[model samples]
Target: MKYVQLGNSGLIVSKLAFGAMTFGYGNIPSVYKVGQDQSQELVDRALAAGINFFDTADAYADGQSEEMLGRLLGARRKETVIATKAGNRMGPGLVQSGLSRKHLFDACDASLARLNTDYIDLYIVHKTDPFTPLEETLGALNDLVRQGKARYIGYSNWPAWMAAQAVQIQHERRWATFINGQMYYSLVGRDIEHDTVPFMNNCGVGLTVWSPLAGGFLSGKYTRDNLSDPNNRLSGFDFLPLDKEWGFTVLDAVREIAQNHSATPAQVSLAWLLSQSHVCSVLVGSSKPSQLDDNLSAVDLQLTSEETAKLNELTRPVPLYPNWFTTMTLDGRVVEALK
Candidate 1:
């Protein structure tokens, strides 16, 4: 696995991160039912593959995910860069959720204890909380960094406008700011390109992609002839709001590219993501070790310029509002230079 900086931070991390969301027994059997034995084996395989970055969250499997990951990593925890998130509903109490100071402080301790670590390599706010001020959330994160509870901070699933505001506040306050962002990005889900991509690029926030295969929709397991597979992860968790017909259309192109490169659909999809300059890492989760191995192989598969452009055009997101207007107003020479 190739290594890179976790955003602009001095810290180094693997380009392919192992997502431990599938470590514990989740609500769905396919997701949460993996036992400790299997998790250990998978963890061993990941380490062997040179995947040092492991991502989990407090909300995954009522925190069982952290426990399983901690237990599996055991003595090898020191060799890995563990990233986990907070700000999700962890309890029934009104104070149990959100990015308030109370929850963040308590949540950090809980995550540390669960992960069996003294400090989190990266602590993230899982989602935005309208009720709590960004100041409060960022301040708490800064304190955690200062206290050595979390070494770096970031946010997940946040809009660009709010994220830009957070970046400004952190810089102005001289507090610990964002280092990386973990978001759902795939060939079928390219909406973040309009705003989030530009903002992260300008602000120096790195992106680590989640669900890079659209929950297995781009794994070449689903086709027009076989739209529904009980064995597929999407059958249990179809969280991504992707149109099946559109996904199949995208899959057709991915499949064609895969054949030309002598690779799998999933490899082609992941390789396409790695081609993006703004992407720092891609998180690949799996219930089986073989699936993880397939994803790991993508780092070695290089797509040609023509293939990359074909996928780019096929999956390019439509420009939004002022972005389109801004492009329209650009000088022809400037456009030519960009081309």
Candidate 2:
């Protein structure tokens, strides 16, 4: 697998990171219930395929996800870059969640214990806590780095403005700044491009994309004819919303490209994300090894400039107010002035 530096950080991670959200067996709603044995087999296959980055979260399966991932990696822990998230509700109490100092410290220790590791390669805040001050959350994350509990810090599911503010705060305080931002991004969902991608690119923060397949809608299993597959995750969990009309248009383009490359539509979808220069890694989770293998092949599926442009044109987001106004005002006029 190809390795790249995570944002401005010195740590290098595999472009295709294995997500362990599917590693637990439980009645958790919308979660894939794979047992330890199958999870181990999948992990082994990923490692054998050269994936060195693993992502998990304490909120997944009520923390069982991390435990299963830890057990599976076993002795190969040193060779992997393990990432986990906190700040989600882990229990019934109010104190059980949020990015407050108490919860972060408690959650970090719990994650470390469950993962059987001394330090987390990357510790991310799972979501924004409007109730808690951003300074408190960032300060706690900084302390984790200073204490050697977490090597680097990041945040997930945060608005672009908040993420940019956090980076500025950390710089001002001389604290550990975030090196990455994890968010839902895919061909069907190009919303992040409006702000998050631009902010991250300007601030030197890398992006780790989750739901690159739009939660399985772009997996080729779903089509205009076969819209509802009872066994599909999207049928039950449908997440990271997309405009179905436009989504199908993008899917058509992906299908054409997939046929040309002799690749699965899923691989084509993933390759599209990998083609973005700012994307550091794309997280792929699977209940079976075959699915993992298909995703791994995306790294080798090269899309030509024309094919890439076709997909881009089909799904590109419509320019919103200020952006459209700015483009209208400056784009042509600047060239005229230069002439």
TM-score of each: 0.96, 0.96
lDDT of 2 by residue, 245-277 (tens): 778877888998999999999999999999999
User: How much is 219 displaced in model 1, in angstroms?
Assistant: 0.8
> Residue-wise lDDT of candidate 1 within 173-289, one digit each (tens)?
999989998888999999999999899989889999988988888999877766666776667888789878887888888899899888999999999999888899999988888
lDDT of 2 at 285: 92
Q: State the local distance difference test value for candidate 2.
A: 0.91
> lDDT for each of the candidates?
0.91, 0.91
lDDT of 1: 0.91
- Candidate 2 lands at a TM-score of 0.96
Model 2: per-residue Cα lDDT at residue 53: 94
